[model samples]
Target: MRFLSGREAVLKHIFETDDEAPLTPVAVTVTVTREGRTTAATSGTAIRNGDVYTFAAGSLPLGVYTVRWDGGTAAVDTSWFEVVGGHLFTVAEVRAYDADLSADRFPTSAVVRLRDYIAGEFESITGRSFVTRCRRIPVELDGSCSPLPLVDVQATTFEDSAGQTVYAVSVEPVGPFTLAEGEGSYTAELTYGFRSVPDDVKRAALLRIRTLLFAERSGIPDRATSFQPAEGGTYTLATPGVRGSETGIPDVDAVLGRYGFDVLDDLAGVLL
Candidate 1:
C-alpha cells in the first residue's frame, strides 16, 4: 500500500480457503503498532466478496507500522509498510512558471525530481523547509556558535552529553544563542517549517530549475560546473557566475541572497 507521510494508511487483507476458494464469514483480529506503541487494535469479520474474504483497516498513522492479522487456528500474518512525503512543487506549476516553454520541456517525472531537488537545496542553503509540517525537529550547534542556524523553533531542550539540562538563558523562535558553551544537543518537539512558499523563492527556484534542465538537455554545464585543465592540474577553474546570480535570469540571485540569510540568521543573540 502507498502511504504518504503525515497522512493515514489504509491496509487491505485477503484470505483464501484450502481449495483456493474465498473464505467467507471469517473472523479476524487486526492490530497496528508504531515505535512499540499500539496505535490500533480491532477484531472484525470479513464477509466473502465475490471469491475472497477481505479485511481492511480504517486507517493507520504515518510511520513504520506493524500490522498483525490472526484468523484463529494457527494462521497468523504480519507485515510492514512505510510512508513518505510527496513533491514540493507540481508538474503543472513547473510548466506554469515558464509559460514560454512547451509541455515537453520538462516531463512529469523530471518535474518530480526537479521539485525535490529545489526543495532540498532551499533547506540545505537556508536551513529551512518550504513545506510546513507539525513535527519534532532536532537543532544542532558548534563551539562558540553565535547565531542559531534554524528558524520557527517553537520549543526545544538544551542538553549536554550526560543528558543534563542546559538553560538557554534566552530563546526565540529563530535563534543563534549559547547552550552552556559546551558539547550538547537540542531535541525540539514543536511545529516547524514553512506552511507556504514565498513568491520570490518560488520564482527563483523555477528559474534555476529551468536553467539547469535546458543546460542538461543541451549537454552544457550550468553555473555550478567546474573545470580542471590538464596543464594546471593543481589549479581548478571554478565557474565564474554565482548559483542564483549570473544565470542571465533576473531576480534569481536577488531573491536567493535575501532568503539565504533568512536561512542562516533567523536567530540573533549576544554570546555570553
Candidate 2:
C-alpha cells in the first residue's frame, strides 16, 4: 500500500582486458531516456568515481529508464533496471518453508536471493504473484469485459494513438467492467496484484519449495506428472476419460484453482 520512487544508479567501468582492472576512458557520454524522451544528459567527469560511474547526475524519475554508455573502451552497451519493491516473502517465510522440509537454514545473505528465486518460480507456475507493485500498465479496452488484474487503481486516463488525452471520463471500481465502445485507447497507472499474500498461495509456495528440496536431496529432476479426468462423465462411469494435469503439481494447482486459474485465458476459441 506504500508508493516509492527516486532511485539512483551507479555504473561501473571494468576493463575487458583485465577482469580486475579498472580503466577510466575519455569522452564518456551517459544519456538517460524515460518512456521515450531524453530526461538527463551528462558528461563522464560528473559521475566518475575512480573506476566506477554513478548516475549521480540527478535522481532517476519513477518510470523505467534506458541508460546508454558510450565512448568508453568497451562496446556501446545499454542496460536497465527498475526501482521496484521488495519480494513477496521475507527470509523468515522462506526459512519456514525450509523448516517444513527439514532442511538446514540458508545463510542470511543468501536468504533474500533464494526467496526471490522461489517467488519467481511460484509466479511462473501459478501465472500470478503475491506481492503488489506500482507500474504503468497498458490496458486494452475493446469491449471484451473481464476482471482487471489490479488490486487497486491509482489513476487512469483515456488517450488517442497520437498521445492526446481523450475526453471520456471513467469511474471506479475501474475494472471488471466493459469500456464503452468507440473509445480507441486508454492507460491506467495501477497498483496491481495482492496487497497481502494469500494463505493458499503461501501454502502452494511452501509445497513447491519442499518439492525442490526433496529433489535436491534425492538428486532427481524437480519434475512430476499428474492426471485429471475429462468432463461429461466420471472415471468410474465406464466412459473413457482424458488424462492430464491442470498444472502438473496437484497441491499447487488445487491452491491456484481458487486464486489464479483463468479458464478463458487458456481456452482455445472455436474456429470456422
Candidate 3:
C-alpha cells in the first residue's frame, strides 16, 4: 500500500508480496521522473499484507512528474503533479542567495524588520525623520502566486536627504498616477528652492540612478529618463519592474562627494 499527494502532479504505487501474501519488511525504492528528466529516487520499507505506507512531502518539487516503485518485488506504480517551483527561485518567488540583494535566504518572518532597517538606515544617512506607510504588494504573472507574497512594496516618506533639503524645497507626484499591467513605477511632486540643479551634478546622479535601477534588470529598455521636480514632491520612474521612486536626495552632492545616495546606496538600505 502507498499514499501520494501533490498539486501539479500525482503518483500511485503499492508495496506488497506476490499473490497478496504477507511479505517480510522489504526495502522499496521509488524513482521519480519529469518530462523525461530523471529526478532523485527514494527508499522505503515494505508495507506488509494489509499494511499502509506514507511518504509525506519531504521529497520532490511542484511540477509534472512520474513515480516508479520497485519493492524488490516488481516495477509496480507511477504518478505525477503540477505543484509549483521548478526547483529554487522558479516557484519560491523569493530566494535567499540573491546576488543583487545579497540576502541569505528569502525569510518571510522578517519583512517588516527588513523595511524598518532600511528606514533606519535612510534616517542615519540623511539625518531626517522618515514617516512612511509601507506596503508590500505580492507580484505575480501567469497567475502563479508569489512565494514572497508581497511583490510591490511601497514606502512613502517626507524625509529629506542632505541634498533635497537645500537644492529643492519639495516635489510631489501629479495626481492620477497609473501603473501598466506587469510594470512598475513611482511618482512624486518636487519643488526646487534653488535656481536649478547644476547640469553636471544632475547628469552624474541621473547616470548613477539609471545604471543602478536597470543594470541587472531585464526586459525593459536599456535607457531611462529622469526629470527634476520643480517643487518638493516625489521623483518617480516607471521601469520594467513594478515600481520606481526617489529619496528626493539631490544628486548634486553626489558630484561633490562619493555617490552614496545613488541607486546602489538606496537599494542597499532598502533591499535588506
Query: What clash pairs does model 1 have?
Result: 126-263, 147-176, 148-175, 148-176, 175-267
Q: For model 2, what is the alpha-carbon lDDT of residue 87?
A: 52
Q: Give candidate 1 regions above 4 Å deviation.
A: 1-88, 99-105, 133-149, 154-186, 219-250, 262-272
Q: Of the candidates numbered 1 and 2, which has the greater TM-score value?
A: 2
lDDT of each: 0.53, 0.50, 0.34
For 1-272, candidate 1 gives per-residue lDDT tens digits of 33445554556666545687555335666666552344454345544455344555445443346667676773667766543344355567777777744566556656655666677676676666665533333455454433443454434445444445667524543232223233346643333455567777777787878876786675434543555556865433234254444334555656655655542233322332
18-82: candidate 3 lDDT, tens digit per residue: 69965433555556554323446433433333444334334443234555555555345565533
Task: Order candidates by lDDT, high to low.
Answer: 1, 2, 3
Clashes of 3: 46
RMSD of each: 10.3, 9.0, 23.8
Each model's TM-score? 0.48, 0.55, 0.22
lDDT of 2: 0.50
Greater lDDT among 1 and 2 belongs to 1
Candidate 2 at residue 104, lDDT? 56
Top-lDDT candidate index: 1
Highest TM-score: give the candidate number.
Answer: 2
